[model samples]
Target: MANFSTNEFKAGLKIMLDGEPCNILENEYVKPGKGQAFNRVKIRKLISGKVLEKTFKSGDTFEGADVLDTTLAYLYNDGEFWHFMNNETFEQIAADAKAVGENVKWLVENDDCTITLWNGNPISVTPPNFVELEITETDPGLKGDTAGTGGKPATLTTGAVVRVPLFVQIGEVIKVDTRTGDYVSRVQK
Candidate 1:
Protein backbone atom coordinates (compact mmCIF):
# COMPACT_ATOMS: atom_id res chain seq x y z
CA MET A 1 0.00 0.00 0.00
CA ALA A 2 1.18 3.51 -0.74
CA ASN A 3 0.22 6.80 0.86
CA PHE A 4 -1.33 9.55 -1.21
CA SER A 5 -2.28 12.99 -0.08
CA THR A 6 -5.79 14.23 -0.71
CA ASN A 7 -4.41 16.43 -3.48
CA GLU A 8 -3.49 13.34 -5.47
CA PHE A 9 -7.02 11.99 -5.64
CA LYS A 10 -8.38 11.21 -9.08
CA ALA A 11 -11.14 9.17 -10.61
CA GLY A 12 -10.59 5.38 -10.83
CA LEU A 13 -7.98 5.43 -8.07
CA LYS A 14 -8.44 2.61 -5.57
CA ILE A 15 -7.93 3.41 -1.94
CA MET A 16 -8.46 1.72 1.39
CA LEU A 17 -10.73 3.38 3.89
CA ASP A 18 -11.48 1.89 7.26
CA GLY A 19 -9.89 -1.35 6.02
CA GLU A 20 -12.36 -1.59 3.09
CA PRO A 21 -11.70 -1.13 -0.61
CA CYS A 22 -13.17 1.91 -2.36
CA ASN A 23 -12.67 3.55 -5.75
CA ILE A 24 -12.65 7.26 -6.33
CA LEU A 25 -15.56 8.20 -8.54
CA GLU A 26 -15.00 11.95 -8.43
CA ASN A 27 -12.67 14.31 -6.67
CA GLU A 28 -12.66 18.07 -6.43
CA TYR A 29 -10.20 20.36 -4.77
CA VAL A 30 -12.25 22.84 -2.82
CA LYS A 31 -11.11 25.92 -0.96
CA PRO A 32 -13.06 28.98 0.09
CA GLY A 33 -10.93 32.07 -0.51
CA LYS A 34 -9.27 32.24 2.92
CA GLY A 35 -10.26 28.86 4.26
CA GLN A 36 -8.18 25.71 4.30
CA ALA A 37 -8.02 23.61 1.15
CA PHE A 38 -9.52 20.13 1.05
CA ASN A 39 -10.51 17.45 -1.37
CA ARG A 40 -14.17 16.51 -1.75
CA VAL A 41 -14.39 13.00 -3.04
CA LYS A 42 -17.22 10.71 -4.00
CA ILE A 43 -16.18 7.08 -3.67
CA ARG A 44 -17.86 3.79 -4.39
CA LYS A 45 -17.27 0.65 -2.41
CA LEU A 46 -15.72 -1.98 -4.64
CA ILE A 47 -17.42 -5.01 -3.12
CA SER A 48 -20.85 -3.61 -2.21
CA GLY A 49 -21.24 -1.03 -4.99
CA LYS A 50 -22.31 1.54 -2.41
CA VAL A 51 -21.28 5.16 -2.91
CA LEU A 52 -20.34 7.66 -0.24
CA GLU A 53 -18.85 11.13 0.02
CA LYS A 54 -15.91 12.12 2.15
CA THR A 55 -13.70 15.13 2.62
CA PHE A 56 -10.05 15.20 3.52
CA LYS A 57 -7.67 18.00 4.25
CA SER A 58 -5.17 18.72 1.52
CA GLY A 59 -2.35 17.62 3.77
CA ASP A 60 -4.03 14.44 4.92
CA THR A 61 -2.75 11.16 3.56
CA PHE A 62 -4.68 7.99 2.77
CA GLU A 63 -3.61 4.46 2.03
CA GLY A 64 -3.78 3.73 -1.67
CA ALA A 65 -4.62 0.19 -2.60
CA ASP A 66 -2.01 -1.85 -4.42
CA VAL A 67 -3.84 -2.51 -7.65
CA LEU A 68 -2.10 -4.12 -10.60
CA ASP A 69 -3.03 -4.50 -14.23
CA THR A 70 -2.06 -7.27 -16.59
CA THR A 71 -2.92 -8.02 -20.20
CA LEU A 72 -4.89 -11.23 -20.51
CA ALA A 73 -6.58 -13.08 -23.31
CA TYR A 74 -10.28 -13.73 -22.85
CA LEU A 75 -11.13 -17.37 -23.41
CA TYR A 76 -14.53 -19.01 -23.81
CA ASN A 77 -17.02 -18.76 -20.98
CA ASP A 78 -17.81 -21.86 -18.91
CA GLY A 79 -21.50 -21.18 -18.36
CA GLU A 80 -21.15 -19.46 -14.99
CA PHE A 81 -17.55 -18.23 -15.06
CA TRP A 82 -15.70 -16.08 -17.52
CA HIS A 83 -12.21 -17.42 -18.08
CA PHE A 84 -9.08 -15.46 -18.96
CA MET A 85 -5.50 -16.52 -19.54
CA ASN A 86 -2.49 -14.54 -18.46
CA ASN A 87 -0.49 -13.51 -21.49
CA GLU A 88 2.85 -14.10 -19.80
CA THR A 89 2.36 -17.33 -17.83
CA PHE A 90 -0.62 -18.78 -19.74
CA GLU A 91 -2.30 -19.45 -16.39
CA GLN A 92 -6.10 -19.36 -16.43
CA ILE A 93 -8.19 -17.39 -13.98
CA ALA A 94 -11.95 -17.54 -13.75
CA ALA A 95 -14.00 -14.61 -12.58
CA ASP A 96 -17.69 -14.20 -11.93
CA ALA A 97 -19.85 -12.51 -14.56
CA LYS A 98 -20.31 -9.48 -12.36
CA ALA A 99 -16.60 -8.78 -12.59
CA VAL A 100 -16.86 -8.78 -16.37
CA GLY A 101 -20.40 -7.36 -16.41
CA GLU A 102 -21.34 -5.37 -19.52
CA ASN A 103 -17.86 -5.82 -20.98
CA VAL A 104 -18.94 -9.31 -22.02
CA LYS A 105 -20.64 -7.79 -25.03
CA TRP A 106 -17.38 -6.40 -26.38
CA LEU A 107 -15.39 -9.56 -25.73
CA VAL A 108 -14.54 -11.85 -28.64
CA GLU A 109 -12.90 -15.21 -28.21
CA ASN A 110 -9.11 -14.87 -27.95
CA ASP A 111 -9.38 -11.08 -27.62
CA ASP A 112 -6.76 -9.38 -25.46
CA CYS A 113 -7.92 -7.14 -22.63
CA THR A 114 -6.59 -5.43 -19.57
CA ILE A 115 -7.57 -7.20 -16.41
CA THR A 116 -7.21 -5.28 -13.19
CA LEU A 117 -6.19 -7.44 -10.26
CA TRP A 118 -6.64 -6.51 -6.68
CA ASN A 119 -4.68 -8.71 -4.28
CA GLY A 120 -4.05 -11.18 -7.12
CA ASN A 121 -7.79 -11.58 -7.82
CA PRO A 122 -9.63 -10.26 -10.85
CA ILE A 123 -11.41 -7.07 -9.94
CA SER A 124 -12.38 -5.64 -13.30
CA VAL A 125 -12.03 -6.33 -16.99
CA THR A 126 -11.63 -3.64 -19.63
CA PRO A 127 -12.27 -4.50 -23.23
CA PRO A 128 -10.60 -2.97 -26.23
CA ASN A 129 -11.69 0.60 -26.83
CA PHE A 130 -12.67 -0.14 -30.37
CA VAL A 131 -13.57 -3.31 -32.22
CA GLU A 132 -14.37 -4.28 -35.78
CA LEU A 133 -17.39 -6.52 -36.36
CA GLU A 134 -19.63 -7.45 -39.22
CA ILE A 135 -23.15 -6.15 -39.40
CA THR A 136 -25.40 -9.21 -39.22
CA GLU A 137 -28.69 -7.57 -40.13
CA THR A 138 -30.18 -4.18 -41.06
CA ASP A 139 -32.72 -2.72 -43.45
CA PRO A 140 -31.58 -2.33 -47.03
CA GLY A 141 -30.95 1.23 -48.13
CA LEU A 142 -34.05 2.96 -49.41
CA LYS A 143 -34.30 4.18 -52.98
CA GLY A 144 -33.22 7.84 -53.45
CA ASP A 145 -32.02 8.08 -49.82
CA THR A 146 -28.75 9.41 -51.23
CA ALA A 147 -28.35 12.19 -48.63
CA GLY A 148 -27.42 9.50 -46.03
CA THR A 149 -28.69 11.59 -43.12
CA GLY A 150 -30.78 8.84 -41.59
CA GLY A 151 -29.40 5.58 -40.21
CA LYS A 152 -30.75 2.10 -39.64
CA PRO A 153 -30.28 -0.15 -36.66
CA ALA A 154 -27.81 -2.97 -37.28
CA THR A 155 -26.91 -5.98 -35.16
CA LEU A 156 -23.32 -7.11 -34.82
CA THR A 157 -22.04 -10.66 -34.66
CA THR A 158 -21.70 -10.29 -30.90
CA GLY A 159 -25.44 -9.51 -30.63
CA ALA A 160 -24.96 -5.81 -29.79
CA VAL A 161 -27.09 -3.47 -31.82
CA VAL A 162 -25.80 -0.15 -33.13
CA ARG A 163 -27.09 2.41 -35.56
CA VAL A 164 -25.16 2.66 -38.79
CA PRO A 165 -25.65 4.74 -41.86
CA LEU A 166 -28.23 3.49 -44.33
CA PHE A 167 -25.49 2.51 -46.72
CA VAL A 168 -24.34 -0.18 -44.30
CA GLN A 169 -25.58 -3.58 -45.46
CA ILE A 170 -25.65 -7.04 -44.03
CA GLY A 171 -22.30 -8.85 -43.89
CA GLU A 172 -20.36 -5.59 -44.09
CA VAL A 173 -17.64 -5.13 -41.49
CA ILE A 174 -17.62 -1.91 -39.45
CA LYS A 175 -15.67 -0.43 -36.62
CA VAL A 176 -17.42 0.24 -33.33
CA ASP A 177 -16.44 2.25 -30.31
CA THR A 178 -17.15 -0.03 -27.39
CA ARG A 179 -16.95 2.81 -24.89
CA THR A 180 -20.12 4.38 -26.29
CA GLY A 181 -21.47 1.42 -28.30
CA ASP A 182 -21.59 3.65 -31.36
CA TYR A 183 -20.52 3.12 -34.93
CA VAL A 184 -17.19 4.62 -35.86
CA SER A 185 -17.01 3.90 -39.55
CA ARG A 186 -17.37 1.11 -42.05
CA VAL A 187 -14.47 -1.26 -42.28
CA GLN A 188 -13.00 -1.65 -45.73
CA LYS A 189 -12.82 -5.40 -45.43
Candidate 2:
Protein backbone atom coordinates (compact mmCIF):
# COMPACT_ATOMS: atom_id res chain seq x y z
CA MET A 1 0.00 0.00 0.00
CA ALA A 2 1.17 3.55 -0.72
CA ASN A 3 1.61 6.08 2.06
CA PHE A 4 0.71 9.74 2.18
CA SER A 5 2.98 12.25 3.85
CA THR A 6 1.64 15.21 5.76
CA ASN A 7 2.21 17.36 2.70
CA GLU A 8 -0.32 15.24 0.85
CA PHE A 9 -3.02 15.61 3.48
CA LYS A 10 -6.03 17.52 2.28
CA ALA A 11 -9.76 17.45 2.36
CA GLY A 12 -11.40 14.41 0.68
CA LEU A 13 -8.18 12.41 0.81
CA LYS A 14 -8.96 8.94 2.03
CA ILE A 15 -6.42 7.13 4.16
CA MET A 16 -6.28 4.24 6.58
CA LEU A 17 -5.82 4.90 10.26
CA ASP A 18 -6.05 2.44 13.10
CA GLY A 19 -6.93 -0.17 10.51
CA GLU A 20 -10.05 1.74 9.44
CA PRO A 21 -10.80 3.98 6.50
CA CYS A 22 -11.11 7.71 7.13
CA ASN A 23 -11.55 10.71 4.87
CA ILE A 24 -9.69 13.87 5.63
CA LEU A 25 -12.28 16.55 6.13
CA GLU A 26 -9.88 19.40 6.77
CA ASN A 27 -6.11 19.85 7.04
CA GLU A 28 -4.22 22.90 8.16
CA TYR A 29 -0.50 23.28 8.41
CA VAL A 30 0.65 24.95 11.59
CA LYS A 31 4.28 25.92 12.07
CA PRO A 32 5.25 26.84 15.57
CA GLY A 33 7.71 29.62 16.28
CA LYS A 34 10.52 27.17 17.16
CA GLY A 35 9.47 23.64 16.34
CA GLN A 36 8.59 21.33 13.47
CA ALA A 37 5.52 22.01 11.35
CA PHE A 38 2.57 19.72 11.90
CA ASN A 39 -0.72 19.13 10.17
CA ARG A 40 -3.90 19.66 12.09
CA VAL A 41 -6.54 17.55 10.48
CA LYS A 42 -10.20 16.87 10.90
CA ILE A 43 -11.15 13.44 9.72
CA ARG A 44 -14.33 11.45 9.46
CA LYS A 45 -14.44 7.70 9.78
CA LEU A 46 -16.02 6.52 6.56
CA ILE A 47 -18.00 3.65 8.02
CA SER A 48 -19.11 5.29 11.26
CA GLY A 49 -19.40 8.95 10.21
CA LYS A 50 -17.44 9.90 13.28
CA VAL A 51 -15.47 13.13 13.05
CA LEU A 52 -12.08 13.29 14.72
CA GLU A 53 -9.39 15.92 15.07
CA LYS A 54 -5.82 14.77 14.89
CA THR A 55 -2.37 16.27 14.57
CA PHE A 56 0.52 14.74 12.70
CA LYS A 57 4.12 15.80 12.54
CA SER A 58 5.51 17.01 9.25
CA GLY A 59 7.15 13.66 8.61
CA ASP A 60 4.19 11.54 9.62
CA THR A 61 2.65 9.27 7.07
CA PHE A 62 -0.42 7.05 6.60
CA GLU A 63 -1.44 4.39 4.16
CA GLY A 64 -3.89 5.23 1.39
CA ALA A 65 -7.28 3.67 1.95
CA ASP A 66 -8.42 0.90 -0.33
CA VAL A 67 -11.53 2.79 -1.24
CA LEU A 68 -13.11 2.98 -4.66
CA ASP A 69 -15.92 5.25 -5.78
CA THR A 70 -18.09 4.17 -8.67
CA THR A 71 -21.08 5.71 -10.36
CA LEU A 72 -24.16 3.49 -10.19
CA ALA A 73 -27.82 3.81 -10.95
CA TYR A 74 -30.34 3.68 -8.13
CA LEU A 75 -32.60 0.67 -8.07
CA TYR A 76 -35.52 0.04 -5.74
CA ASN A 77 -35.07 -0.50 -2.05
CA ASP A 78 -36.46 -3.40 -0.04
CA GLY A 79 -36.73 -1.49 3.25
CA GLU A 80 -33.68 -3.30 4.64
CA PHE A 81 -31.27 -2.24 1.93
CA TRP A 82 -30.96 0.05 -1.08
CA HIS A 83 -29.89 -1.43 -4.38
CA PHE A 84 -27.59 0.12 -7.00
CA MET A 85 -26.27 -1.11 -10.31
CA ASN A 86 -23.16 -0.39 -12.33
CA ASN A 87 -24.40 0.07 -15.85
CA GLU A 88 -21.05 -0.65 -17.42
CA THR A 89 -20.77 -4.07 -15.85
CA PHE A 90 -24.39 -4.70 -14.98
CA GLU A 91 -23.18 -5.60 -11.48
CA GLN A 92 -25.32 -4.75 -8.48
CA ILE A 93 -24.79 -4.09 -4.80
CA ALA A 94 -27.08 -3.57 -1.86
CA ALA A 95 -26.23 -0.92 0.68
CA ASP A 96 -27.71 -1.08 4.11
CA ALA A 97 -29.16 1.95 5.89
CA LYS A 98 -25.86 2.76 7.52
CA ALA A 99 -24.12 3.10 4.20
CA VAL A 100 -26.98 5.04 2.64
CA GLY A 101 -27.14 7.39 5.61
CA GLU A 102 -29.29 10.50 5.12
CA ASN A 103 -28.90 10.19 1.33
CA VAL A 104 -31.98 7.97 1.33
CA LYS A 105 -34.24 11.00 1.22
CA TRP A 106 -32.79 12.11 -2.11
CA LEU A 107 -32.86 8.81 -3.94
CA VAL A 108 -34.97 8.67 -7.11
CA GLU A 109 -35.52 5.66 -9.27
CA ASN A 110 -32.95 5.26 -12.08
CA ASP A 111 -30.89 8.23 -10.93
CA ASP A 112 -27.13 8.01 -10.93
CA CYS A 113 -25.35 7.81 -7.59
CA THR A 114 -21.80 7.52 -6.40
CA ILE A 115 -21.10 4.53 -4.18
CA THR A 116 -17.81 4.00 -2.40
CA LEU A 117 -16.58 0.47 -2.03
CA TRP A 118 -14.10 -0.65 0.57
CA ASN A 119 -12.71 -4.11 0.35
CA GLY A 120 -15.20 -4.71 -2.43
CA ASN A 121 -18.18 -3.82 -0.20
CA PRO A 122 -20.13 -0.61 -0.09
CA ILE A 123 -19.26 1.91 2.61
CA SER A 124 -20.99 5.04 1.38
CA VAL A 125 -23.47 6.28 -1.22
CA THR A 126 -23.96 9.80 -2.57
CA PRO A 127 -26.83 11.02 -4.65
CA PRO A 128 -26.51 13.67 -7.30
CA ASN A 129 -26.12 17.29 -6.22
CA PHE A 130 -29.32 18.36 -7.94
CA VAL A 131 -32.49 16.36 -8.43
CA GLU A 132 -35.91 17.13 -9.87
CA LEU A 133 -38.68 15.38 -8.01
CA GLU A 134 -42.42 15.66 -8.20
CA ILE A 135 -44.25 16.88 -5.16
CA THR A 136 -46.42 14.12 -3.85
CA GLU A 137 -48.02 16.04 -1.00
CA THR A 138 -48.32 19.65 0.10
CA ASP A 139 -50.87 22.20 1.20
CA PRO A 140 -52.89 24.00 -1.45
CA GLY A 141 -51.27 27.17 -2.74
CA LEU A 142 -52.89 30.42 -1.72
CA LYS A 143 -54.72 32.24 -4.53
CA GLY A 144 -52.62 35.43 -4.45
CA ASP A 145 -49.96 34.85 -1.81
CA THR A 146 -46.73 35.35 -3.69
CA ALA A 147 -45.47 38.43 -1.88
CA GLY A 148 -43.15 37.19 0.82
CA THR A 149 -40.56 34.45 1.20
CA GLY A 150 -42.91 32.35 3.33
CA GLY A 151 -43.17 28.80 2.12
CA LYS A 152 -44.75 25.49 3.00
CA PRO A 153 -43.29 22.06 3.52
CA ALA A 154 -43.70 19.87 0.47
CA THR A 155 -43.16 16.14 0.51
CA LEU A 156 -41.44 14.94 -2.61
CA THR A 157 -42.06 11.65 -4.34
CA THR A 158 -38.84 10.39 -2.75
CA GLY A 159 -40.28 11.27 0.68
CA ALA A 160 -37.89 14.19 1.25
CA VAL A 161 -39.60 17.25 2.69
CA VAL A 162 -38.42 20.62 1.44
CA ARG A 163 -39.65 24.11 2.01
CA VAL A 164 -41.00 25.48 -1.25
CA PRO A 165 -42.60 28.74 -2.34
CA LEU A 166 -46.31 29.05 -1.76
CA PHE A 167 -46.97 28.89 -5.48
CA VAL A 168 -45.67 25.34 -5.73
CA GLN A 169 -48.46 22.80 -5.90
CA ILE A 170 -48.70 19.08 -5.62
CA GLY A 171 -47.66 17.07 -8.71
CA GLU A 172 -45.33 19.86 -9.87
CA VAL A 173 -41.71 18.94 -10.46
CA ILE A 174 -39.16 21.11 -8.69
CA LYS A 175 -35.41 21.11 -8.60
CA VAL A 176 -33.78 20.41 -5.27
CA ASP A 177 -30.20 20.74 -4.12
CA THR A 178 -29.46 17.55 -2.28
CA ARG A 179 -26.29 18.92 -0.77
CA THR A 180 -28.20 21.55 1.18
CA GLY A 181 -31.69 20.07 1.03
CA ASP A 182 -32.98 23.34 -0.41
CA TYR A 183 -35.49 24.03 -3.13
CA VAL A 184 -33.87 25.36 -6.29
CA SER A 185 -36.63 26.09 -8.80
CA ARG A 186 -39.87 24.88 -10.27
CA VAL A 187 -39.67 22.72 -13.37
CA GLN A 188 -42.19 23.12 -16.14
CA LYS A 189 -42.57 19.39 -16.57
Candidate 3:
Protein backbone atom coordinates (compact mmCIF):
# COMPACT_ATOMS: atom_id res chain seq x y z
CA MET A 1 0.00 0.00 0.00
CA ALA A 2 1.21 3.51 -0.79
CA ASN A 3 1.57 6.09 1.97
CA PHE A 4 0.06 9.57 1.77
CA SER A 5 1.75 12.33 3.75
CA THR A 6 -0.40 14.97 5.44
CA ASN A 7 0.74 17.59 2.96
CA GLU A 8 -0.68 15.49 0.12
CA PHE A 9 -4.07 14.98 1.74
CA LYS A 10 -6.97 16.33 -0.26
CA ALA A 11 -10.65 15.75 -0.82
CA GLY A 12 -11.52 12.46 -2.58
CA LEU A 13 -8.23 10.81 -1.58
CA LYS A 14 -8.72 7.36 -0.09
CA ILE A 15 -6.56 6.23 2.82
CA MET A 16 -6.56 3.60 5.52
CA LEU A 17 -7.46 4.79 9.00
CA ASP A 18 -7.75 2.47 11.96
CA GLY A 19 -7.66 -0.47 9.51
CA GLU A 20 -10.71 0.84 7.64
CA PRO A 21 -10.85 2.48 4.24
CA CYS A 22 -11.94 6.12 4.29
CA ASN A 23 -12.26 8.92 1.74
CA ILE A 24 -11.07 12.38 2.66
CA LEU A 25 -13.85 14.91 2.49
CA GLU A 26 -11.89 17.98 3.62
CA ASN A 27 -8.31 18.80 4.54
CA GLU A 28 -7.44 22.01 6.37
CA TYR A 29 -3.91 23.04 7.23
CA VAL A 30 -3.49 24.69 10.62
CA LYS A 31 -0.49 26.19 12.38
CA PRO A 32 -0.73 27.37 15.96
CA GLY A 33 1.12 30.48 17.12
CA LYS A 34 3.75 28.45 19.01
CA GLY A 35 3.31 24.84 17.90
CA GLN A 36 4.05 22.82 14.79
CA ALA A 37 1.70 22.79 11.82
CA PHE A 38 -1.02 20.13 11.53
CA ASN A 39 -3.69 18.98 9.14
CA ARG A 40 -7.34 18.73 10.14
CA VAL A 41 -9.24 16.28 8.01
CA LYS A 42 -12.81 15.14 7.63
CA ILE A 43 -13.29 11.67 6.20
CA ARG A 44 -16.09 9.26 5.51
CA LYS A 45 -15.72 5.54 6.05
CA LEU A 46 -16.23 3.58 2.87
CA ILE A 47 -17.99 0.56 4.38
CA SER A 48 -20.18 2.11 7.06
CA GLY A 49 -20.87 5.53 5.55
CA LYS A 50 -19.75 7.27 8.73
CA VAL A 51 -18.14 10.69 8.82
CA LEU A 52 -15.36 11.55 11.21
CA GLU A 53 -12.93 14.39 11.92
CA LYS A 54 -9.32 14.00 12.95
CA THR A 55 -6.16 16.05 13.30
CA PHE A 56 -2.68 14.89 12.33
CA LYS A 57 0.75 16.40 12.81
CA SER A 58 2.48 17.77 9.78
CA GLY A 59 4.33 15.21 7.64
CA ASP A 60 2.23 12.34 9.07
CA THR A 61 1.62 9.56 6.59
CA PHE A 62 -1.29 7.17 6.05
CA GLU A 63 -1.56 4.06 3.95
CA GLY A 64 -3.48 4.38 0.70
CA ALA A 65 -6.68 2.40 0.34
CA ASP A 66 -7.46 0.29 -2.70
CA VAL A 67 -10.57 2.05 -3.91
CA LEU A 68 -11.90 2.33 -7.44
CA ASP A 69 -15.02 3.63 -9.15
CA THR A 70 -16.58 1.62 -11.97
CA THR A 71 -19.64 2.09 -14.11
CA LEU A 72 -21.99 -0.91 -14.24
CA ALA A 73 -25.44 -1.63 -15.56
CA TYR A 74 -28.05 -2.44 -12.97
CA LEU A 75 -29.49 -5.94 -13.38
CA TYR A 76 -32.01 -6.71 -10.60
CA ASN A 77 -32.60 -6.81 -6.89
CA ASP A 78 -33.19 -10.23 -5.33
CA GLY A 79 -34.63 -8.80 -2.08
CA GLU A 80 -31.29 -9.01 -0.32
CA PHE A 81 -28.77 -7.80 -2.87
CA TRP A 82 -28.85 -5.47 -5.85
CA HIS A 83 -26.98 -6.92 -8.80
CA PHE A 84 -25.03 -5.05 -11.47
CA MET A 85 -22.95 -6.03 -14.46
CA ASN A 86 -20.04 -4.53 -16.34
CA ASN A 87 -21.32 -4.17 -19.90
CA GLU A 88 -17.98 -4.56 -21.59
CA THR A 89 -16.50 -7.29 -19.41
CA PHE A 90 -19.79 -9.06 -18.71
CA GLU A 91 -18.74 -9.35 -15.07
CA GLN A 92 -21.36 -9.10 -12.37
CA ILE A 93 -21.24 -7.85 -8.78
CA ALA A 94 -23.75 -7.90 -5.94
CA ALA A 95 -24.15 -5.07 -3.45
CA ASP A 96 -26.07 -5.41 -0.24
CA ALA A 97 -28.82 -3.06 0.87
CA LYS A 98 -26.39 -1.10 3.02
CA ALA A 99 -24.15 -0.41 0.08
CA VAL A 100 -26.97 0.66 -2.18
CA GLY A 101 -28.61 2.78 0.55
CA GLU A 102 -31.15 5.37 -0.60
CA ASN A 103 -29.86 5.37 -4.17
CA VAL A 104 -31.79 2.14 -4.72
CA LYS A 105 -34.94 4.20 -5.27
CA TRP A 106 -33.44 5.83 -8.35
CA LEU A 107 -32.04 2.67 -9.89
CA VAL A 108 -33.76 1.04 -12.86
CA GLU A 109 -32.79 -2.09 -14.68
CA ASN A 110 -30.31 -1.49 -17.56
CA ASP A 111 -29.35 1.90 -16.16
CA ASP A 112 -25.68 2.69 -15.81
CA CYS A 113 -24.53 3.55 -12.27
CA THR A 114 -21.21 4.40 -10.70
CA ILE A 115 -20.23 1.89 -8.00
CA THR A 116 -17.43 2.64 -5.60
CA LEU A 117 -15.41 -0.45 -4.73
CA TRP A 118 -13.03 -0.94 -1.85
CA ASN A 119 -10.72 -3.92 -2.08
CA GLY A 120 -12.72 -5.25 -5.05
CA ASN A 121 -16.07 -5.13 -3.18
CA PRO A 122 -18.81 -2.56 -3.47
CA ILE A 123 -18.94 0.08 -0.74
CA SER A 124 -21.29 2.59 -2.28
CA VAL A 125 -23.49 3.16 -5.33
CA THR A 126 -24.25 6.42 -7.14
CA PRO A 127 -27.22 6.83 -9.46
CA PRO A 128 -27.16 8.95 -12.57
CA ASN A 129 -27.92 12.67 -12.36
CA PHE A 130 -31.16 12.41 -14.33
CA VAL A 131 -33.66 9.70 -15.22
CA GLU A 132 -36.93 9.47 -17.12
CA LEU A 133 -39.59 7.31 -15.51
CA GLU A 134 -43.30 6.82 -15.99
CA ILE A 135 -45.71 8.13 -13.42
CA THR A 136 -47.45 5.14 -11.93
CA GLU A 137 -49.90 7.10 -9.83
CA THR A 138 -51.08 10.70 -9.47
CA ASP A 139 -54.28 12.66 -9.15
CA PRO A 140 -56.01 13.95 -12.24
CA GLY A 141 -54.97 17.38 -13.38
CA LEU A 142 -57.31 20.30 -12.92
CA LYS A 143 -59.06 21.71 -15.97
CA GLY A 144 -57.18 24.49 -17.84
CA ASP A 145 -54.00 23.77 -15.83
CA THR A 146 -51.81 23.12 -18.84
CA ALA A 147 -49.78 26.22 -17.92
CA GLY A 148 -48.20 24.24 -15.02
CA THR A 149 -48.86 26.94 -12.41
CA GLY A 150 -48.69 24.48 -9.49
CA GLY A 151 -47.31 21.06 -8.65
CA LYS A 152 -48.64 17.83 -7.21
CA PRO A 153 -47.03 14.76 -5.76
CA ALA A 154 -46.68 11.89 -8.21
CA THR A 155 -45.45 8.37 -7.77
CA LEU A 156 -42.96 7.16 -10.35
CA THR A 157 -42.48 3.71 -11.82
CA THR A 158 -39.46 3.15 -9.57
CA GLY A 159 -41.58 3.84 -6.44
CA ALA A 160 -39.97 7.21 -5.73
CA VAL A 161 -42.39 10.10 -5.36
CA VAL A 162 -41.75 13.69 -6.41
CA ARG A 163 -43.72 16.84 -7.00
CA VAL A 164 -44.65 17.25 -10.64
CA PRO A 165 -46.36 19.98 -12.57
CA LEU A 166 -50.17 19.97 -12.53
CA PHE A 167 -50.16 19.03 -16.21
CA VAL A 168 -48.33 15.78 -15.47
CA GLN A 169 -50.48 12.68 -15.28
CA ILE A 170 -50.27 9.00 -14.55
CA GLY A 171 -48.59 6.90 -17.27
CA GLU A 172 -46.70 9.99 -18.44
CA VAL A 173 -42.95 9.73 -18.48
CA ILE A 174 -41.17 12.60 -16.71
CA LYS A 175 -37.55 13.53 -16.35
CA VAL A 176 -36.37 13.65 -12.72
CA ASP A 177 -33.19 14.97 -11.19
CA THR A 178 -32.06 12.15 -8.93
CA ARG A 179 -29.72 14.24 -6.81
CA THR A 180 -32.48 16.60 -5.68
CA GLY A 181 -35.51 14.39 -6.31
CA ASP A 182 -36.99 17.25 -8.31
CA TYR A 183 -39.14 16.86 -11.41
CA VAL A 184 -37.42 18.36 -14.42
CA SER A 185 -40.07 18.12 -17.09
CA ARG A 186 -42.59 15.79 -18.72
CA VAL A 187 -40.96 13.47 -21.24
CA GLN A 188 -42.60 13.79 -24.63
CA LYS A 189 -42.31 10.08 -25.33
- TM-score each candidate: 0.80, 0.90, 0.92
lDDT of 2: 0.92
> In model 1, how many backbone clashes occur?
0
Instruction: List, residue by residue over 2-117, the lDDT tens digit for candidate 2.
Output: 99998898788899998889999999889989988988999999998899999989879999998988999999999899999988899999999989999999998899999999
Local error of candidate 2 at 130, Å? 0.9
By lDDT, is 1 or 2 better?
2
- Full-model lDDT for every candidate: 0.84, 0.92, 0.91
* Candidate 3 lDDT score at position 47: 79
In candidate 2, which residue ranges exceed 4 Å CA deviation?
Answer: none
Better of 1 and 2 by TM-score: 2
* Candidate 3 structure quality by residue, lDDT tens digits, 1-189: 899999888899999999889999999999989999999999999878899999999899999999999999999999899999999999999999989998888998899999999889998999989988999999998856864466889998879999988877889999889999998987888
lDDT assessment of candidate 3: 0.91
Query: Model 2: what TM-score?
Result: 0.90
Evaluated with TM-score, which candidate comes out highest? 3
In model 2, pairs of residues that clash are none
The digit string of per-residue lDDT tens for model 1 on 51-94 reads 99999887898899877778889898889998999778989988
Model 1 off-target regions past 4 Å? 10-12, 18-20, 23-27, 32-36, 42-53, 143-147
Return the candidate ranking by lDDT, descending: 2, 3, 1
Which should have the higher TM-score, number 1 or number 3? 3
Q: What's the true lDDT of residue 90 in model 1? A: 89
The count of backbone overlaps in candidate 2 is: 0
